[model samples]
Target: MAPTTPRPPTMRDVARTAGVSTATVSRYVNGLQRFTEATEARLREAIDQLGFTVDPVARSMITGRTHTVAVVILDIRNPHFTGIVKGANRKAQQLGYNLLFVDTGERQSAEAGMLRELSRRVDGLIVSSRMPDADLSTLRDLDKPVVFFGRASQVGVHSVSADGRSAAAMLGRHLIDLGHRRIAYLGYGAARWDAERKAGLTDALREAGLEPMFFSADSPTLEAGEKSVGEVLMGSARPDAVVCYNDMLALGFMKQAQAAGVRVPEQVSVAGFDDIPFARFSTPTLTTVDMQSEAMGELALERLIELIDGTLDASEEMLKPRLVLRQSTAAKVRT
Candidate 1:
C-alpha cells in the first residue's frame, strides 16, 4: 500500500509543529498569551495548517468575569484624572480587576464610541465628563454599572467627585478674609461648577459688601491662563488678586504678572487650585486648594466596586478641600 498522506492536524499536531508545549499552544490559540512577533507568526502558520478552532463554551468557562474596568477621561493631561486613576488602580489590584484606560481627549464622538464598545467588554466603567450622560443613563437603565469622576450629574449611573464647590468656596473665603475686595476668578469647567464656586465666593463677598470679577475660559491650560491674565493687566480695570483653575494656569498667570512688572502680593497676588506636585516649588510658593486627588481616586474605586456588586446604591459624596498658604497671599500691599 502506498504511504498514507498525513491526516488532518489537531491542536496537539500544531503544538508539535510549533515546537511548544500543549499549554503554550492553548494560550496562543486563545489569545491569552503574549509572545514575540516571530513566535506568534509561527503559531499562526501552525494553526492555519491544523485548522484549529477554539470552543466558545470552553472559553467562557475559563474567564469567569470580564476582568476589566474601563477608565474613560477627557484630558489625561489633567492631574485630577490621574489622581482618580491612581485610586482606581489601587482598588482594582486589590479586587483582581484589570484597568483599561482610554483618553477621549475631550472629544464627544470618541467618548460616545468608547461607551458603546466598552459596555460590551468591561464589567464596569468610570467616566470623567458630562456629555455622555444619556448614554450612561441607558447603560444604567439596562443594568450596566458606570461611575462619573470629578464632575457630578444626577443622571450618572454612579458618581464620584471631590467637594469642588466647597473647595472653590474655601479659596473664595480665603481671598475675602485677606481683604481682597477687587478679586478675579480665573475659572474653568461647566457652568455648574463655575456657578457653584462663584456662588460661594459671592456669598462670602456679599457678606463683606464686595463682588468678584469673573473670567470664563475654555480650559485651565497654561496658555489660556497667561492670556487671561495678560489681558486683564493691560486693561483699565484689573483685579488686585486672581484665583486660578489649577496650578499650571496659576503659574502662567504669575509669570505674566511678573513680565508686566507687577510685584506679586504687592501689586497683585495669584493663587491656584489642586495644589499639584509642582505647586510648592513655583517661584512664589503658590497658595492653593487641595482636591485630595489620591483620596478621591481611592474612594471612587471603593464606591464603584460596591455599586458593581450590588452592595451600594448610587450616591454622591464630596471631599472637603484644604487651603495651603504660602508666599502667594499676604495682607494686601498698601496701595
Candidate 2:
C-alpha cells in the first residue's frame, strides 16, 4: 500500500492549540481584529509550534487581491530593462508583494496579449511599450492600474520616464563646447524616443547656427552601429562627431572605427545615451546620458501601487537625466 501523506496544519489545529475559537484565530491570522496581549501571544506560540503558514490562494480568494504585480518590458536582454526589473522586484519583495516579468521581444501583439492575460492574475501592471498611441490607449479598458515606463502617459494612464529631449540637448551642447561641428545622428527609426532626442540635438545645433546630418541604423544594436562606420565615418564629408541612440551603438561604432585605423575623440568623437554599466568600462570610457533607469522602475512600481490603492490619480512623472563626461569625446582638432 502507498504511504499516506500527512495533512497540513490548518486554522482549526492552530485554534485548538491556542485555546481560541476558529473565528478568533482567523481574525488574528488575517489581521482583521485585535486581541489581548496574552491571547495574541498564545496564538503566535500556536502558529510557531504548528509551523502554520497562510495559504496564498485561500487568502487571495478572501481578499480579492493576489499580492502580485506584473512588469512588461520590450527586451529582457537589454541591461536598461533588466535594471528596471531589479528595482521593481526589490521594492515588491519589501512590500510583501510578488513580481511577474514578461519580455515582449519588442513585439506589439505579444505585449498586448501578455498584458491582457496578466491583468487577470496580477493586481497591477508596469509596461515599457513601443506600440503606437492608438494601441496603447486601449489598455485603459483592462480595468487594472497601469504605470508606463520610459514612455509618455496616455489619457488615463500614469507614466514615469527620463526627459530624453533635455538630456540629448545637454549632450549636444557638450559636444558643441568641445568644438565638434558637422555632427551626425545615428539612430534606429523604431524607437519612441528617437524623435525627441533628434529634436533636442537639432535644437542645440540650431542655436549654434548649424544643422545636423542624419543617418539610420536598422536596429539599435551594437552590430548596427559597427556597420554604419563606413557611411558615417569614411564617406565624403565625414562627420566630425556622431551621437548614437544608446550606449551599445556607441561602443560598437568605436570598436569598428578603431579597427579600421581611426582614432576616437581625435579623428571622430562618439557619444551615446543611456549611460549603461558597460559604458564607463569600455575603451575610452563612453560619454553618455544617465537616464536613471533603476529609479524610474522603482517610482513606476510605487505609482502603480498607489493607483491600485486608489490613493493616486492618473499622472505623469518625468525624471531628470544627467550628462556623463568621459574620454570618448574631446575638442575636435582642426585639419
Candidate 3:
C-alpha cells in the first residue's frame, strides 16, 4: 500500500487561518484590492504559516492574463537576435513576466504559422520579421498586442529599430573619404533591411558624383561572403572597397581574400554593419556600425507592455546608429 499525497494549501486555508473572508484573501492575493496594515499583517502571517502559494495557472484563468510574452525572431544563431532576446528577457523577468521565443529560420511562411500559434498562448508579442509590408500589416489584427523589433509597419503597430539607412550612409561616406572610387555593397537579397541599407549607400555615392555598384549574397553568412570573392574581388571591375551587410560577411570576405594573396585595406578595404561581438577581435579588426540591438530589445518589450495596458498609441521608435572605426579600413593607395 502507498501513502496518500498531501494537498497543497489553498486560498480558503489561508483565509481560515487569518480569520478573514475568502473574498478578502482573493483580493489580497491577486493584488485586486488593498487591506489595512493590521489586516495585511494577519494575511501575511497566515500565508507564511500555511505555506500557501498562488497557482499561476489558476490565477491566470481568473485574471484573463498569463503574464507571458513571446518574441519571434528570424535566426537565433545571429548575435544580433541574441542581443535582442537577452534584453527582452531581462526586462520581462524584472516585470514578473515570462518570455517565450520562436525562431522562424528566416522563412516568411513559417513566421505566419508561428505567430498564430504564439498569439493564443501569450499576452503579447515582439516580432523581428522579414516578411513583406503587406504581410506585416496583418500583424495588427492578431489577438495579442504586437511590437515589432527591427521593422516598422504602416498598419498602426508599435515598433523599435535602429536607423540603418543613416548608418549605411555614414559608412559609405567614410569609404568615400578614404579615396575608394569603386565602392560596392555586398548584401543578402532576402533581408528586410537590405533595401534601406542599399538606398543609404546609394545616396552617399550619388552625392559624391559616383555610381554605387551592387552585389548579392545568398544569405548573410561567412560562407556567402567567402564565395563572392572571385566575382567581387577578382573580376574586371574589382571594387577598391566593399561594404557588407553584416560583420559575418565582412570577416568571411577578408579571410578568403587574404588566403588568395590579396591584402585587406592595402588593396581592398572592407566595412560592415552590426558590430557583433566577434567583429573587433577578427584579423585586422573590423569597421562596423553599432545598431544598439540590446537597447532596442528592451524598448520593444516596454512598448509591448504599454500596448497591452492601453497606455501607448501605435508609434515607431528609431534609435541612432554609430560607426566604429578599426584597422580593416584605410585611405586607398594611388596606383
Candidate 4:
C-alpha cells in the first residue's frame, strides 16, 4: 500500500506551535494586522518548520485579485510580437504577476472571443489588435482594465505605438533620394497601421511625381512575399525598388529574388519596416525601420499594471521610429 500523505499544516497548527491565537496567526499571515517583533519572529519560525506555503488561489479569494494579466497579439511567429512578449513577461515576473499570452493568428474575429474569455480570468490585458476601430470600440464594455499596443483606437482605449506613417515616409524618402523612381510596395491586408504606412509612402512618392506600384499579400510572412514576387516581377512595368511592410516579407522577396539570379541592390533595391533580428543577419543586411518593440512592450505592461492598480490615467503614447541603413538598398544605377 502507498504511504499515507502527512496531514498538511494549517493556520491552527502554526498558531499552536507559535503559542498564538488562530485569529492572530490569520491576521499576521494575511497582513491584515501587525504583531510584536518577538511574536512575528516566533510565527515565522513556526511557518518555516511546518514547511507551509500560501495558496495563491485561497489568497485571491480573500482579496479579490488574481494578480495576472493577459497579453493578446497577432502571429506569435513574428519576431516583433515575440520581442514584445519577452519585455512584457520580464516585467510581469518581477511584479509577482502571472502572464497569459494569446495569439489570434492575425484573425480579427478571433480577437473578440479571446478578449471575452480571458478577461474573466485575468486582472488586466495588453492587446495588440488586428481588429478595425469599430470592432475595437466594443471593448469599452469589457469590465477589466486594458491597454492597446501597436495601434490606436477611437474607442478611447489607452494605446502605445510607434509612428508608422513617419517611418514609412522616411524609408520612401531614402529610396527616392537614391534614384529609385519606380518603387513597388509589398504589404499585408487591411489594418490601421498598414493604411498609415501605405499612405505615407504613396504620398512621399507622389510628391516626387513617381507612380507607386502596389502589391499585396494575405499575410506578412515570408511565404506571402515569395508567392507574390512573381506577379510583381512579371508585370508589364517592373519596379527598380521594392519597399516591404516588414522585414519578414522583405526576407522572403530577397530569398526568391536570389534564387532567380536577380542581384540585390544592383538591379533592384529592397527595404522593409521593423528591423527584426534576422534583418541584420541576412545575406545583404536589410535596410528597415526599428519600431522599438521591446520598449513598446515594457511601456504597455507598465501602463496595464497601472490601470489594474488604479494608478494610470488613460493616455496614448507614440514611440519614435529609427532607420537602420544597410546593404540591401543602394543608389540605383541608371542604365
Q: Which of the numbered candidates is closest to the native, going by highest lDDT?
A: 3
On a 0 to 100 scale, what is the lDDT of residue 331 in model 4?
97
Candidate 1: residue 173 Cα off by (Å): 1.9
Model 2 segments more than 4 A misplaced: 1-9, 12-50
lDDT of 2 by residue, 1-335 (tens): 99999898999999999999999988887656899999999999999999999998888886688889999988887788888999899888777789999988888766676788889999999988887877777578789999986554556888899998998899899999999989999988788888889999999999999999999998778898899899898888999899999888899999999999999989989999988899989999999999998888888888888988789988778999999999999999997
- TM-score per model over all chains: 0.77, 0.89, 0.90, 0.85
Q: How displaced is residue 258 in candidate 1, in Å?
A: 1.7
Q: Whose TM-score is higher: candidate 2's or candidate 4's?
A: 2
- Which 10-residue window in model 1 sums to the lowest lDDT? 133-142
lDDT of 2: 0.88
Name the weakest run of 10 consecutive residues (lDDT summed) in model 3.
Answer: 149-158
Number of the candidate with higher lDDT, 1 or 2: 2
Top-TM-score candidate index = 3
* lDDT of all predictions: 0.74, 0.88, 0.89, 0.86
Candidate 1 residue 223 C-alpha distance from true site, Å: 1.5
Report how far off residue 64 is in candidate 1 (Å). 4.8
Model 3 C-alpha RMSD to native: 2.7
